[model samples]
Target: MNTIEKQKLSVLIITLNEELYIKSLLKDLDFADEIIVIDSYSNDKTTAIVESFKNVKLIQNTFEDFTTQRNFALEKASNNWILFIDADEKLSPELKSEIINTINNPNPASAYLVYRTFMFKNTKLRFSGWQTDKIFRLFDKLKCKYTTEKLVHEKLEIKGEIAVLKNKLIHYSYTNFDDYKAKMKRYGMLKAREKFKKGHQPSFIMMLLHPIYTFLYQFIIRLGFLDHTNGIIICYLNAYSVFIRYKELKKITSSRI
Candidate 1:
């Protein structure tokens, strides 16, 4: 652990067949006192590559729900403050510097929410719903951990204030249109199940109207138009995702009842 004015810091990342981006992140965050990688038994060279890094601590767990997986990763962390990174995401140089400075200056706040800039292909996506996608990825371990229930997009429950960082965590969420669609199918299904179990019912009117509203909201109101063709594609796909979720929820409900 590097000596600093503040408490020790831990970094945690979740992965499954993510051999591509994991190494770069570990290299960049070499200052982390502990780097815990909770992998879902990746069959690829992910484990082999990760083992090559002296600083990384790799643990294999069976594929489980995302909430459980994240909570498990949280348990493996060994420091007071944790910086959560996804296997596919990388901490920008500016963000890396900011993280060090923030911890050294340890605020009373329980956590810090960082901004994310998603890149598709070689282009940096500046519009659509992803523009303002901020997440609470840095936190004091004692003060917070992930919620144990929500599966797909789990969030932490914290009681203290949250500080914001200016630098962004670069998210390589989409490699191409095909990747985006495939992810949408998986995520939409998960979201639908959650919503269904929570007793959220969307009427026929809502199904018809909401998707359109969402498209306009993201592309027009959110100014996704500024991004050109990518913006339009994003809005359409996101709206389509909503429709798929609703449709899948209906299927789940019908089968159960």
Candidate 2:
């Protein structure tokens, strides 16, 4: 269906140096009433590619934590209903249809959780703790905003009821191994800062054990091994991120003394 036939909904996204996937993802939003891209002042072709889509509004802001950027988008949205999506995410036809119908419901939910089929750089992993990945992507902007505890993950604070959609969003996968590693490292740094702000300190034992537990939990309990090689890599990366988080926290605290 064309955009005009769909309900008035603003699709929001926060991006940073996502030139590779921006074009294709934008193309898929043809059914959205309005598309708004909030960029973190990328030094790449991200903004240029976004401008190519005249219908989509491109706004650049200095890089900040995830919650801040997302809340900023809420204020910029003209429509009461908004769908927050990532640059690396795509909506299947079925999922798009479900969203349209849900919004048009006589008494629909205030927010909705959309599950994802996460791809690890072109390869889809069935297990590895990714199978249950879900996000609150659709919501009423008037009733929801991201909580302030943001650095690693941004969570929505909803005032009303939330529901889940059956169809899944396609996570377009990461850039590459090295790129993903850098991404994880960045997240770890942010996480450490956030924890420090909360008056939390990392112990030597916690730092040492957290990563080990992370690896074991995902790889064993979550069945990352079932996914074979890629799953193992993902589990390792997750574990490393935990270790880095603690390591950064320790550094931040020690410097204060």
Candidate 3:
């Protein structure tokens, strides 16, 4: 009897009270050889749901900056081939096939940039500065890891060759208008804290201009206006987030002084 070996893939996902979406995402990652979830002691049924899945291995750690949490996940991954995805992100059938083929190739890139389609409450955002959204998802664990010292947007440092995949990874991050606003505010707060750590002083000129520039950049320059009301709403929210970040930064700086 001859058996063909399948390429080993270890999927890593970081979570925090993601009971609402993680179960469905875990189901989609069933094809992976191993699925490791680094949860931040979620006070929800997220762990319960994950435990129900036979293939998933759940580990709890206290919540911290995004980079620290993601790096922790990377340390827990067993296989060298890693596919890092969020609880709100999922792979389409075509993307799943492509990833399998890529992993099986003898000479694949050290890491790959996967395009992400942003969805806002069931609407696919074709604009609002999200059209070119991409991230390094699939990669060789030995060759790549998170590097940027940010508390919000964790960036990966990749070594050797990099390539882009054809299929887009679906992102169901924001569920509704309120959900978007809540997330924006939280991200803004985290970003402000990161800036404060870097000794970024509060500037009145930046406070006034950054948000305005952000609105213009998103709405006018990025063609977000063409996406109509949805785009308009996101652009406004994005600008508001910038305002919130500066506002929080001022508070943090004042308290320190």
Residue pairs clashing, model 1: none
| Order of quality (TM-score) | 2, 3, 1
Candidate 3 lDDT tens digits, 1-257: 97656679999999888998998999898679899999989888999999999889999999778888888988988899999999999789999999999988878999999999999878898998999999889999899988757888887788899999999999997787887898889888888999998989988899899999999999999999988998989998888899889999999999988
- In candidate 2 the C-alpha lDDT for residue 72 amounts to 89
The backbone clash count of each candidate, in order, is 0, 0, 0
Q: Of 1 and 2, which scores higher on TM-score?
A: 2
The lDDT, on a scale of 0 to 1, for candidate 1 is 0.83
- Candidate 1: tens digits of C-alpha lDDT, residues 131-165: 89999898887888777557688878887778898
Q: Listing every candidate in turn, what is its Cα RMSD in Å to the true structure after a full C-alpha superposition? A: 2.8, 3.0, 2.1
Top of the candidates by TM-score = 2
Which prediction has the highest lDDT against the true structure?
3
The residue pairs found clashing in candidate 3 are none
Report the error of model 1 at residue 57, Å: 1.5
**Least accurate stretch of 10 residues (summed lDDT) in model 3?**
2-11
